[model samples]
Target chain A: MKLTLRVWRQKNADAPGAMAAYEVDGVSPDMSFLEMLDTLNEDLIVQGEDPVAFDHDCREGICGACSLVINGDAHGPERTTACQLHMRSFRDGDTIDVEPWRAAAFPVVRDLVVDRTALDRIIQSGGYVTAPTGSAPDAHAVAVPKPDADHAFVHAECIGCGACVAACPNGSASLFTAAKVNHLNVLPQGAPERESRVLDMVAQMDAEGFGGCTLAGECATACPKGIPLQAITTMNKEWLRAARTSKR
Target chain B: MSWTSCGWPPYGRRMALATRDRRPPTVRTLWDSSVGKKTVMAVTGLIMLGYLVAHMAGNLKIFFGADEFNGYAHWLRHLGAPVLHSHWALWIVRVGLVVSVVLHGVCAFQLSRRDIKARPVRYAHTKARTSYATRTMRWGGVILALFVVWHLLDLTTLTVNENAQAGHPYENVVATFSTWYGNVVYIVAMLALGLHIRHGFWSAAQTLGVGSAARARLLKGAANLLAAGLTIGFISVPVAVMTGVVN
Candidate 1:
């Protein structure tokens, strides 16, 4: 298959970027989106031209490292991650536009690579349990309710690919923050610091200069992990509970 | 949980206290986020929606006759009389509504500016994933605002009402709706209001943390019912006047 790719190119974060067009032929339907990019890079190397730079790791899609907005969607037309998107999704002679995750917090590092440290900062603020290293506890020691465990596991599936932030019109990290908040806050292990966890994570999220959640709900639609939009509502509930109960 | 060197410092004792102390007062912090503004919008919107329902119920008295409608309107101003004073309850309600409207507008405007600032570079080819009501909320709000001004001038103050009659609420309402332009404006504004409430109620549920996956369907149904019922309720008077049913 032949395809025209208009990929965003930039020298660095401070440099101006624009859409650079390239034509690639002999594409196989089985080739994953990243594999197609690899072929394009090989062709570019042969021509002594600079290849497009995009972030990808563990091409199997679990690592959440691949970030590309294809044809205006966070992870292309499919609800799956960029690494999982195959060339067969597009027809022959198609023009695909690819760009980095655009957000005020996620600045373009180079070409399709963006600095997603803001997401890391939010996690750092309070996305984890406070349990210290020790012998593993018996599985039945906590005895979490089935429904709460199920809900927590569902939210725990988030891969933090920054798609939620990228896809949000407001660049809000509400979905991402909510996923982390609910995943732990629902479990008995995370109950000790639940209130403070919501407060600190939300504060850090705000400090990172991310936008607010307008309930536009594009983040959930763009989410490759299938993170439910209701996670945000749950987080809001947690925040409200914490805000009212906490002394501070 | 396994610990990895992910570049961020671990959540430590001092760090938690430091973060907590650094946080501003609860109210200031609450108003700082988009979520905060949305909460304000949702609460205030509910307040206004309540007033609308009550007002609509009052307006339905027009069907009973001139005495019933005028007497109902008269009763609105005279409620709590002898115990309090004439128009005191009405003025309190008016003041509450004005405050809600102002706060809702300010929060909406600020949140819009923030949303625009978040994405400096627009998408070349965009695909909408939200509902039409959600997308058109700002425009719907503007329509409702303009309608409120016109409605007040035409009916409340009798400034824009050409066939204005003093002290006769029923005649004033009928005279205003009797005009073709008046009907058009009222009907159009009612439609906008319906759309606004449709999205606003569901959104308010989510923002106020009252909605859940199990109850989403119920909440949506209620929103639809409220929007449809209110639109029909408010438009019935103008339609009745235009059709000579109330004349």
Candidate 2:
């Protein structure tokens, strides 16, 4: 399959970028989206042109590293992440417009590559259990209610791709953050630092200059992992309690 | 101070003026119109909800004693640390709250209108992606607004109407709930408030960009607990008043 690719090009963060058109011929439909990009880069290298730069690490979609906004949709209209998206979805001679995730916090590094360190900062703020993960305790000692366990598992599946942020009109990451908060706090072991975790993570998320959530529902709609927006609501309730209790 | 386009020459100002024609095309507005209003609605709605929680807490002081409840309200009217709370301060807060309410209503109306206009063709199978709180935000706001007005009339106006107790402001609350309709409305409104608060609490965090997985989960849990508490607190007032628990 031959296709026209209008790819975003920029030398660096400070440089102006625009969509530069490239025509690639003799492409296979079975090639994954990233694989097609690899082929295009190989062709560019042979012609002494700088190949497009994009972030990808485990191309299997679990790493949340492959970030691309195909056309106007994040992760290309699929419920899955970019790495899991295959080229067969596109038709012959299709004009594919590719761009980086647009958000103030996730600035474009070069071409399709973006600096997602802000996500890491949000995680570092409170995404972990403060309780010492010591030697293994008796496995059957703590029995979690079935519903609680299911809810925690649902929240634990977030990949932190920033798709929720990108898809959100306000560029809010509450859905992503809430999932993390709920996942750990529901378990009995995570109780000690639950309040502090909520406070620290929320504070860090704000400090990173992410926009507020307007509840437009687009973020959850675009989320590859389908993380619910309810998680953010849960976080808010905790913050209020923490704020109030601390004042006392 | 001067026009520069990346070393490219600016189009001739005279040429631009010539191209400036009468009857300028009406610029189509996107989010700055629709989604922007929704944002304002979401934000102000959250503020109003915060006020509801605080207001309920204040009202629930009646459970302590009439003197305590009255003192709480009186203190609110006169309780500013550096500057004493006065009639003017009370009115100012009231006005501010009213303004927030109005802004919330206007933005909601505009956003809903846009939503209706944008999608004239309804989908065959479309489930609203909204949560319970978001789905009922408008209804909750309306209920709260009505409650505010009625509550003021119940306390401030002291109308010697048949429905109200003649000389007792507290008794009016009791008498209103003694009837089934009054209890029903109050309970229903509180439920609406619960729904609103459930969504609003966490939404406020998201709007402020403080949402994270752990924090969000905690916030949602807290919001549910708070909503339940507020509902019970508000409902307890009517229940207590009707049962003659409070003289």
Count of clashing residue pairs in every prediction:
0, 27
DockQ class, candidate 1:
medium
The residue-by-residue lDDT of candidate 1 on A130-149, one tens digit each, is 77667988878789999999
Name the top lDDT candidate: 1
Task: Give candidate 2's TM-score.
Answer: 0.56
For residues B78-177, write the lDDT of model 1, one tens digit per residue: 9888886999999999999999999999998887777777778876657777788888898899899889989889888899988888789899998988
Question: TM per model?
Answer: 0.94, 0.56
- Model 2 C-alpha lDDT per residue in residues B1-247, reported as the tens digit of each score: 1122233234321111111123121121112323234345657767776777787888777788867776666677675644754766678778878888888777666545433432232222134555768767767777877876766665567542246754444556656667687677778888887887787776666644466666766877988998899888888888787777875
Worst 10 residues of 1 chain A by lDDT: A239-248
Model 2 error, position A23 (Å):
1.1
Cα shift from native, residue B220, model 2 (Å): 18
